[model samples]
Target: MIILFRIRRWLFKYIYHLIIILSLPLISLFSYNHLLNNHYHPKLINYTTLNQLYINNNTLFDNLFHSNKITSKFPISERSFSSLNDDVFQYGCRDPIMESSKNKRLNAAFVVLARNTEIDGVILSMRSLERRFNQWFNYPWIFLNDEPFNDEFKSRVEEVSSGEINFGLINSLNWHFPNNLENSPFFNEVVENQGDRGIMYGNMKSYHNMCRFYSGFFFEHPLIKDLEFYWRVEPDVEFYCDLTYDPFLEMKKNNKKYGFTITIKELINTVPNLFKLTNKFIIENNIKLPDTWSLFSNNMKFFKGENEINYKDVKNLDDFFRNLIKNTKYNYAKNVINNNNSDNDKQIPSKLLSKLNKLIINHSNSLPKSINEKFNDESYNLCHFWSNFEIASNELFTSPQYKAYYKFLEDSNGFFTERWGDAPIHSLAAGMFLNLSEIHYFRDIGYKHSTIGHCPYNSPNQLPYIPSDKFKHQVLPQDEIYMSEIDPPIKNPLINSNLGASGCRCRCPSDHREVENSGGSCSSLWLKLNDNNFPNSNSLTNHQLNLDLIENWALNSLMDWINNNGNIDDWEISQSERDLLSKNVI
Candidate 1:
């Protein structure tokens, strides 16, 4: 009897182990199906219970792993379950390296958007500039992709752009973890997490790259580190305004390092993960971070709990991220208020806020913008549009002092998560490191999905803040570009794009250094130019004019176009700039 009982116990143990093994694939299959059958969004939970589950060891795994039975389909596949390593995208490099530093070059390359563009978009955008203002493509364009650039894509861009292009490959290695799915330790758990919006716990290479971008900025990519300036471009992008000065020259003169378009509350989708990495940074980098780096509110309304929100209150954030904070007049009055001794050195309640903010932002409280202005050394500030559309020489990129740039990004394990992209971080880093006067906001460049804008002649400090003139304090040094407003806005527009399409213009309102183009729609000029009969040729090429005359003609013509077109759509050409720029026939 005793022998038989012992045998039964041993058999039962073996059976249990076998059952667990058999369930692994089934779990993965079911999880994948669930995600495919449903939309990928997290169900709401009570903050108290969420906190409890986070701390309670027993409920932690169960709550996190409890799958929500849902399904998804193919078209969504591209944007779906980015955390998994199943499939990814690729970017292209037009040719090898056209230019590089003498003693440096690594696996570095910039990803420029160059796909799904209009048939005559490139020519049209260029022609729009030419008919209105003859100009060359100022910034180097980079192309990125999940697949290789076919002859058609490459050939088309080459012919249209006159070979003005470079490419980056977003292969499995670069876009995702190098680990194999079969051998991964977290295989089961990753399967369980398939439906999660945040692509954590899997082989999401782009996510990883984005994280590293925020924390470990890349000044050393084989393609980028050696070059000081990178002008981010994308397919189907547009430029409606005429440029009077060289943005690249301004960037060099002022010492401004990075630039960007928008700044939203970075904590929305990033607080939890940002906290995870930031905590690691505190413990690992050995650098002393300021107090108030991470603060959370009990109220969800502030962060647009369930819907898209524009922030109306910039004054309430200073105490939460003290180190990176820029105390402007508006900030002191709006953000800091009377709290003289707020404890800024506390953990930010990352998980408390949702990814959206419903607040109606008051730009009047912002700092002066450098939209149409040139760089001014006396004040040493860099605030303007297309801050991200940059131009840098090899010398600026290879500077030894720039070592800190990429170091910060790599250390944060930032390149491993998909929740955050590198845009906001890059903007912040540039604003902080680049000299104020050296920074520039390109007043001419235009992108369809841009968040920042530098209108012609709109110098820094031209604009007033949204609420209080004192609210200008909320911005960081880098964000000087979007700090101020000249006349208050009727409204601020939303700028968006595909993944890495245009660069990630992260919403780090914490620094208030966002670049924006009050573009609720296309500039009126673009609308006039959209007529099929718009000039398809560059007449300036045949003119016997000197460089100065060429530039003046272009500038005046562009201004005329803006006047006639009313500055609404980006490239509409129905209204001509000055009835006619020149009568000399091409």
Candidate 2:
């Protein structure tokens, strides 16, 4: 009996040990997975947890990742830690105060022109805007389509929008080629030629129709006509930052007529004759040029025998003209410079000299023969506020001046033959009609459309860490960082009070910089012409400033000469200098 009892005890002890040994691998695997699923997966962290983390400590990382429990159990390398912080930085910190109903809302609606196939893309844009801005204001949205919106598109968009949603069919007259031109062979030929030349959206009749519609008729639509203001949103575009305040209210409060986020040069080929047509209309109607007109006019100054053609002042003229001519075709340079004057030594007529100066300054090597030939003395700089995104009072478009301008362009058939884009049209009209102060640049908004995007960074003083080669791949500890850490804590240039954070919860790249002067952006020119402050303007060298000043003087002189009917007497040149000018024909 004693032996049997001892044998049972030994078996029980050995079996228990065997069971624990068999489960060891499984237990370790489960533990590892749990740590990864809970700690590594950022999506698992809910907004509530994030808000809690923010509340516990003002910083996102100090409380959550820096906790000893998480650090010890799930070790993170410095690079991984930095990457995690970057990922969190994208969400930015949201402001609950933005949810207050006491905030005044604007009588504005978001206008989207899309087709059924773009429903998914439209949903993304709608959801992004709702989360970023509209959730706070609850403004209504109006969707316009050439065809009826399908149930799926309507339901899906409705599901994402926080505000009341309405769908309307665009009038056929507004969205199609005019009945007179629909079957015109000339129109077809132009389309075919532009397509063959590979102009963006040049061959697509529907694309041109869409551009024309947006430029002339969208604002007049019944659904949008009643609204005081409209924000044009497009499919697949993204709003990367939180807009804590109502942009419509901002527009109204500041008496702004137009607002845009991205400014870029238009494809010169797409709008070959637009500038000429616009110039002609201005002259015929005696349209008063706005101060902002300089934004569109080329600022290059070519000597018109105004000042004694000092060799010192014109030393760089050779290189400047050389580079300009070299970039364009030889034939084009000849056409612009020849001016039918066979005699090269005799004094050129003041009229001919003025024409030559205007041609040289207005000419752009980038333009094709078709476009270059249309350059007037007051040439378009082609710096246009991209129209894909616009916030403006509806009154701006419905005004008689803009209406007449649109009608003139439409009657000329440039929208059909030349594939003129609405972007440049809107830009030119705004420059002509609105004051510099009336047109707002939404610098605080972070936006991305296809390849081009603008991601804003805080001022250098407000940056949490100044990126350097030494810490290029490292994220500094954000412990004990207060909102005051950002010098001034509130930098809303437009609004004086502390409203919801303007760019809160942005998920853009930490290293992404604003390409204001490069990559086809013309914001630099816009700033210089309007005298608005540019971020990098202070970095310009004194030599660059001198060159700019010279160009400005030249532009003003040329305009004055033209306005005065080529009279050199107004220039106050001495008779000897006038003789010297007359002796040379450039």
Top candidate (TM-score): 2
Query: C-alpha displacement of 327 in model 2, angstroms?
Result: 18
TM-score of model 1 (CA atoms): 0.37
lDDT (Cα, tens digit) per residue for candidate 2, span 1-586: 9999999999999999999999999998786544333311111112333335334422223213333453333222110111110111222233424433556666789999999999888977876676556765678889999999999998887777767889999999889987778888888898988999999899999999999999999989999988899999999987765566567876777778889888888888887789889999998899887766766765233334332222112212233333322222223324535745566565556876665555455544333343223243446667899888999889989999999999999889888788888899998999889887788777667788887777543321222222222111211122112211322223334333222222443445433445452446766454433432221222111112233333344445544664678643233333332223222332
lDDT for predicted candidate 1 compared with the true structure: 0.32
TM-score of each: 0.37, 0.61
Tens-digit lDDT string for candidate 1 (1-586): 9999999999999999999999999998787554333321111222333335334533212112211211111111111111111111111111111112122322222335334443344433433322111122223445655456667766655543422467655444444434674246554344335326553433453344434432333334455555555555433344433233334444544454443322223323432343334334335545432211111111111112111122222221121111112221122223322232366654323331111011113334343343211111011111122223434343444555334544554444434433444544443334334432333323223333434332221111111112221121322333233222111111112212121111111112221211221222111111112223223221121221122332245444434554585331232222132123222222
- In order of listing, the candidates' clash counts read 130, 4
lDDT of all predictions: 0.32, 0.61
What is the C-alpha local distance difference test score of candidate 2? 0.61
In model 1, the runs with Cα more than 4 Å from the true position are 1-134, 137-147, 162-172, 180-222, 275-418, 431-447, 450-586
Task: Report lDDT (Cα) of residue 213, candidate 2.
Answer: 94
lDDT value, residue 354 of candidate 1: 15
